[model samples]
Target: MHQNNLSDLHRFIDRPTSTWSGRNDGAGAAHRRVHQAVTSLGQGAPDSADAVFIGFASDEGVRRNGGRQGAADGPAALRSALGQLALAQGRNSLRHTDLALLDAGDVVVSSDLEEGQKKLAAAVRASVDAGVLPVVLGGGHEVAFGTYTGVADSRTRKTAGSATSQQPGRLGILNLDAHFDVRRAEQPTSGTPFYQALTRERAADTSCRYTVLGISEANNTQELFDTAHELGADYVVDEDCGVLNQQALLSTVREFVASVDIIYLTLDLDVLPASIAPGVSAPAGYGVPLEIINVVLKEVAASGKLAAFDVAELNPSFDSDGRTAQTAARLIHTVLTYYTPLSSAAPSLR
Candidate 1:
């Protein structure tokens, strides 16, 4: 039944490998890492997996906006970076043996970018159907719409009262972005995802509960802020989101997580400082540091409300020595590892 929904994802995936050289045994277990762990989401019936990854490999939305236009390659760059890390980073134990990650491959996007988003939504819906969380590797921030579509559609299928459950409460959207991305565009672009979401939610009579962190006041026009305000959206500027403000940021995240039944976390690469994540469509000259950003992300992940996740705008074409890809991968790693179920024996459904 899902064969029509998923096109070429299992066939069109990039399998990147990581090289390891060491004692090869008891001492240096270099062979045990992410690359070795991730398997194909076989015919949409993955035998076992904690999270399923789907790549959105189209940059047509970015191209339409005339921004740095190589984010089409972001998915593979993210995979390459993610495949290289140790299964368990030092100072932390990933309990790698307890995790099963599946790489579901990329959505086959053609000239029609909107169609690609639809395909992505289908792929994500399929993953959720299989009792696995979807960690989407995005071509651009435009992927947010598709990601949201999948999560929203799957809400009813979700088990009630669980974090990913579909209960009588609002769905919270938390975007870690430097710009509001709430543009009133005649056509959808990497710059108009959130606005598109808000529009859809309003039309569907879904209560809107959105909060954007790391907003750069100068990067976003006053009109965008006004639109966000009019929509009853909340925000925190870049200056107020640094590592020095950890207490404030965590409190904010905890409060927001408590108010929503489920969370769809979108991490736009541009929200990080240009010095740290320079391979996005637009680099932030003054953005949040990775350490501080991870703190809030970790809190949300462990909160059990995280339903789905998408990392966007990782343009390998603009990266220097793959620093940005690595940063994005690190965030992915943190979220996955930080998520420890309240009762491991009872795997939470997403």
Candidate 2:
């Protein structure tokens, strides 16, 4: 096994001052401009470029729940963590095959539920239109609706008599979470984005598919599972999949994405065991490991079908010495490295 060192961990935590101005014009500005334009237009910006990283921190429900109270700060904290991965150079320095990437800032979400979702949808749509793939950070898993809505709207425009002419293929969701997130709107908690996505009036026309991985049997409701199955979603439980062994799990994920035109990877941090990711909205005793989660993300990135992504449910209030943020950052760095071109090596960790 590759033993991790304190120096290595520390190297990925320090942020650089050179890239903070937002006018670098290299990959960073080219990345931020799309979100700036979209936010300016009050619409979700289309990702017209090769790849773009966008972050969204929706803290609406944090006030009501003690567990997720600090999720609003997750995006910024994660970005800070990712800066330590040394991504200033071309692709050759990366662990995974390099690809182009940029960091688009967070989307603005209001306190009102409906209005916030609409705003998020518009922002996401704008990002997709710019020809850039969006990698969104989260406020909660509920933001999945907005992220998916934007992607679905983009696919709707590209439909060629039932086929999409996009880089990733037909848009679908690969959600890694402890809960199914299939709760209905009767309660409207943060646990219902997938259900809303499947049951929404226009969902059928959008042709979006969902694959839920790492579900905890203790947390799921039978009715929700039945509904997900009815919607044609592939639900894999933690018990059945054997938590950290991602090879078999990734094979199943690959099968689910085989027919899709595009894939959105959504990670609810609660999918990790409570020991690893304790600062989530819902902490579970059993879940995937940190390193294994990285492998899964690497596979998704390698598949080249990744369209957009979101990592949600991080509550800093429960974090110990920012370990949760640190982990989240490493995951985000892996993602950024996955998309950056191999010719440009990531900056060496300081």
Winning model by TM-score: 1
lDDT of 1 at 226: 96
For model 2, the run of ten residues with the poorest summed lDDT: 1-10
Q: Estimate each model's TM-score.
A: 0.86, 0.74
Model 1, 1-350: lDDT tens per residue? 01123334454344422231222233334545566557665534335567778888878888877789888889888988887766654554433334567777777455687887877777676665555668999898889999888777774334424566334346789999998888898888988888888888888776558999999997999999999998889999999998789898888988998787677889999999999998999999999988878877777777766768899999999997999999999899877776643223322222
- For candidate 1, list the clashing residue pairs, or say none: none
- Report the C-alpha lDDT of model 2 over 188-241, residue by residue, as the tens digit: 447777777777624455556788778888887788778777777777887765
TM-score of 2: 0.74
Candidates' C-alpha lDDT: 0.76, 0.61
RMSD to native for every prediction? 5.0, 10.0
Q: In lDDT terms, how accurate is model 2?
A: 0.61
